[model samples]
Target: MIGLCLGLAGLVWAQVPTPAFTLAWDHTIEKIRWEEDYRVTPQGLLLGEARVRGSGAGMEIPEGAELKDGSWRYHRTLPPLQPLRVGRTPEAGDYQLCFDEQCHVLSEWLGPPTAEQPALELWSCAQVE
Candidate 1:
């Protein structure tokens, strides 16, 4: 009975999802760059540990934006979950953000797009097996 219970417990533990993905970026000070780590979670892309030259000297975690490799790729996942991707934004929009050999620009469609909010979303998500 004890062995059976242990086997069942192990099965449950194996099924529990763990943090298997990480995205990192850099912020520079002179020639020195600070590195930040972001963990991909089902709830969202969460800001994790950081190594900085000084307090608040690292890159600001893009809130609600998917952290792609070194750039923030827009996401289409349901709110609060940002899936990271690797690529550049389309080359046809007035909005653009670029820095440190990386960028996150005007891409993806979100909604009907009021003058305030646009109608687009970007980024990629995992597929089911």
Candidate 2:
């Protein structure tokens, strides 16, 4: 099984079971929802798809994106990423990790934030122990 590790400052804070998952959040400026789907692979994490509720400053729809169900959807052909960093602030609310038809706030999984650890990091790891 593949393990998705959520960490702070190079320390693993929590491990979530995953073959695939979606990371979603609202744009800090526009408040529009953005979602990215990823799959855990042996090499790393592979991005499967992305969608956005609407476009705004710094939220441009991709050239080949399709508008469907009030959102712009697109697929990317980028290489697998080893570690993904997500910055968080006390005021910006929480990031959602969705899978198995349910969503959970990141902060809820890892507990409260700290003054030093301002960002959450995600990476593929060995089976959760």
Which residue runs does candidate 1 get wrong by more than 4 Å? 1-29, 54-124
lDDT values, one for every candidate: 0.31, 0.86
Per-residue error at 121 for model 1, in Å?
10
Find the 10 residues in a row with the least total lDDT in model 1.
1-10
Native-vs-model 1 lDDT? 0.31
The model with the greatest TM-score is 2
Query: TM-scores of all models?
Result: 0.28, 0.92
Over 14-36, each residue of candidate 1 has an lDDT whose tens digit, in order, gives 11122332322232233333343
Clashes of 1: 9
